[model samples]
Target: MATYVNPGSAQAGAHGTIYREVSPEQLAVEQQLVDNVVASFDACQDPRLQELMTSLVKHLHAFIREVRLTEEEWGTAIDFLTRAGHITDEVRQEFILLSDTLGASMQTINVNNQAYQGATEATVFGPFFVEDSPAIELGDDLAFGAPGEPCWVEGTVTDTDGTPLAGALIEVWEADEDGLYDVQYEAGKRAGRAHLFSAPDGGYRFWGLTPTPYPIPDDGPVGKMLDAVGR
Candidate 1:
């Protein structure tokens, strides 16, 4: 029979040897790693770190005990995370989508947009939005070079009470008839998109083909996880 002792632990009959149980200081450092993430939950200036960190520490410690996770399990998790990062690119953002699918994005949106009760409910902004899209005039077609069914999208930005928010900016972007964003197609050319500003009455109209829902990029670790989960 063999006895195993964690490093820094004292063995029996080790004369004058002192063994210090894991101190609060060491625990605090380990706890801080998780705390840092929770503390960032609130928009700066609200500082919910104390509450978040406390809960995180409690659950994280509990999880460690619950599974009795070994270092190998932790290492595999790290590798999975690394692969997830490696598969990300400009057109594909596995990490952001992972967060959204996991409900973290919705949670963050709900927490940060507490003031948006009257506004249109915000959803997770997918990763395909392109800045400086070719600005087009109202009623201009966004699917100029694409081949999807032409659908007209008309909406009015209004306050919660139904008062129109005149001159509000409503930017629109979506995939073309081929179910691909401009970024997904050409390397540099901006295609299959258009941007239009709202009218004075908070109304905006755009002509674009309705986009068909497609499976997110399935070539990454996130995709593999989804497959494993039977999603």
Candidate 2:
């Protein structure tokens, strides 16, 4: 027989269980980890956190069991995540890109967001959006000397009832003709982005390059993963 102690853990039960473990008997039990964890939250302060943690534990554990994930595969996944973290910065969110590429981002939005009937639909925004963009007047060109096609856009904001909503603020940003956002340029050179307020009658207009389908950045770990998966 052997006795062991778990540092920082309090004693419990007749044998001083310390903290719960997947005992030999429990190994034969289905959903053992989920049961242990859900029962451990008796003192949980937040109801929502309890619900979230329990549900997450069950789903994540079930997924691992279903896949029978191997140790080597798990290690590779860890390496991928580590590189993704290293490559992320103030301007780049690799995790968001991961979610976006896997369609998880849109799927979550679809499940959570119910747009009002006749309301504008939402799409994935350009990752180049920077805060505190300079405001421009109607018809102002955001091109700002960036090489791109010249274009004009006009629109009016209105409620579901078709009544104009005045003084709506609008944010606009897009890639240049090269399909590179201003944030991706050297020294953070800004272009093809601006903000404007709608007119008293909810009318607005501006000049920007036409949108184009462009290849995503392929130099990071996430990009490599995408490439490996033939995305």
Candidate 3:
């Protein structure tokens, strides 16, 4: 194992770990490597692809250099990604969990969707959001008999101009008080989730489980990462 130490620091013995300060020559070499990698994509035909690849490589290299990343740590990251892939399935997406836990998902959303005056901000598109969710009429109970305290959620959909937007699609889903989503149970089980359209007055309301806090799936690699980082 290798570790980075500040300049002028001294260590006793190397017990399966080597600590050292970065040399100026080594720093130049690292920059050269990054430059060469970035230049290799110069011939890419698509400007957007080339730009994305170059930025990704530059940032990744910068991160590695900033942390003085060790070979062991790199191997651990590879293993973590492998485990994430293994745990992903029809209903489970470890990669999304990884992104969500890292705040990357929310950051991406924020970057793409600019904030307006007092409007709702976009949130993470979690893996549990099912397509074609059960459709319900306004004022109907979206819980569908799911066990939880009855709570009414109502709002008016409007545009930035303060005009009501009729027929706007409204989708809502959340875990029950037990901190379990419908997808966590056996297949074909749907609860605490529904989609409805706003009425002519741009008003919609439905009965759903009261909002509750729930933990992300922590039995997988992403969970291990959070635990490892003391998050």
Backbone clashes, each candidate: 1, 0, 0
Ranking by TM-score: 3, 2, 1
Provide TM-scores for the models: 0.70, 0.82, 0.87
* Tens-place lDDT digits, model 3, residues 1-231: 234455687454355444457776887798899999999999999999999999999889876876678999999999999999998877778899888887899999999999988788888878788888999999999897778889988889998787999999998988988888888886678899999999998999998988888898888999888998999
Model 1 is weakest, by summed lDDT over 10 consecutive residues, at 12-21
lDDT of 3 at 2: 31
Clashing pairs in 1: 39-49
List candidate 2 segments past 4 Å from native.
1-30
lDDT by residue (1-231, candidate 2, tens digit) is 112233454345445444334344544464566688778986899999988888787777665544455799999999999998997878777888888888988888777778888988766664556787878998899878877779889999998898988889899888888888777776467788889998988899998898876677778887898789888
- List ranges where model 1 is wrong by over 4 Å: 1-59, 115-118
- Overall lDDT per candidate, in order of appearance: 0.69, 0.76, 0.85
lDDT of 2: 0.76
The Cα RMSD of model 3 versus the native structure comes to 4.9
